[model samples]
Target: MGPVPWTVNSEIYPEAYRGLCGGMSATVNWISNLIVAQSFLSIAEATGAGPAFMILVGVAVVAFIFVAVFVPETKGLSFEEVERIWQERPQRNRGVAAVPDQKEPLL
Candidate 1:
């Protein structure tokens, strides 16, 4: 959690748009935090803590599934390599670690 967003933001964007994307990502992250913090107590009060937490858990599960399906494995890849992967791979193949005919170890 601590490093994941920063790492993904850095690796996912092209050099020309990295700053813009990073700023947007940070803005979204902070806004999301604000929303949850502001709503948690009210949600808990309306539906006990257990149900409130379960709602959060449900959201987290959906987020996990989205990432698993959409985010590419960027480990050991350079900025150019990462950009190339996104450009060359189809949407369905984006999440795969091993690209066809590529020797690069992507984990």
Candidate 2:
């Protein structure tokens, strides 16, 4: 669920920025997971496990709402269609090429 936006963004953003954005998104996700894990014991102790769990649930709800309102349906759309839509934006034109030879080949 969370990876959807990052995947779309990575596909539509400039090639040069894709890796950075993906890495940042991944790092933030991991960090958030770690924080939640590390904080769970303290949160459960201070505020009760119920409240801590509710907080996590609330975050998920908020994320769902945001996606529902802002994210478009990508279902059934081919990759080319997706790229065509993204290419409409001037800034994204370079990033939305039909063939993305963005990443360097491994030597």
Candidate 3:
């Protein structure tokens, strides 16, 4: 859950910004890894493993909510289509970003 948003960030960014997003995603992953590696033992020591793990579980729940509420569905949409959806203002748009339900290219 901690890293899931970063993975989605890597996947959904438009091509022009994909490289920048990729670097950001990589940075997030590495930073997360470093934090967990450096702090897990201390966290476990300060609070028993049970508590530490529980904290993590709580974090996962929060992350899930954050993703669900804030992240747009991009699984089946093309980058160009997705970009259009996001670039247009909701007030001016009557529909959901013109996002399609396309599963795959017919070709």
Number of the top-ranking candidate, with lDDT as the measure: 1
Candidate 1 vs 2: which has more TM-score: 1
TM-score of each predicted structure versus truth: 0.79, 0.61, 0.73
lDDT of 2 by residue, 1-107 (tens): 45765666645545657778778777887787788889889988999989988988998899889878755566777656666665665466557777666488757
Cα RMSDs, all models: 9.3, 10.0, 11.5
Taken over the whole model, the C-alpha lDDT of each candidate is 0.84, 0.72, 0.77
The alpha-carbon lDDT assigned to residue 48 of candidate 1 equals 100
Candidate 3, pairs of clashing residues: none
lDDT of 1: 0.84
Candidate 2's displacement at residue 41, Å, is 1.0
Clashing pairs in 1: none
Tell me which of candidates 1 and 3 scores higher on lDDT: 1
lDDT (10s digit) by residue, model 3, range 1-107: 55675668755777888888878878877887788789888999999999988987887798789889867888788878787766764545555656655789766
Please count the clashing residue pairs in each candidate, in the order shown: 0, 0, 0
TM-score of 3: 0.73
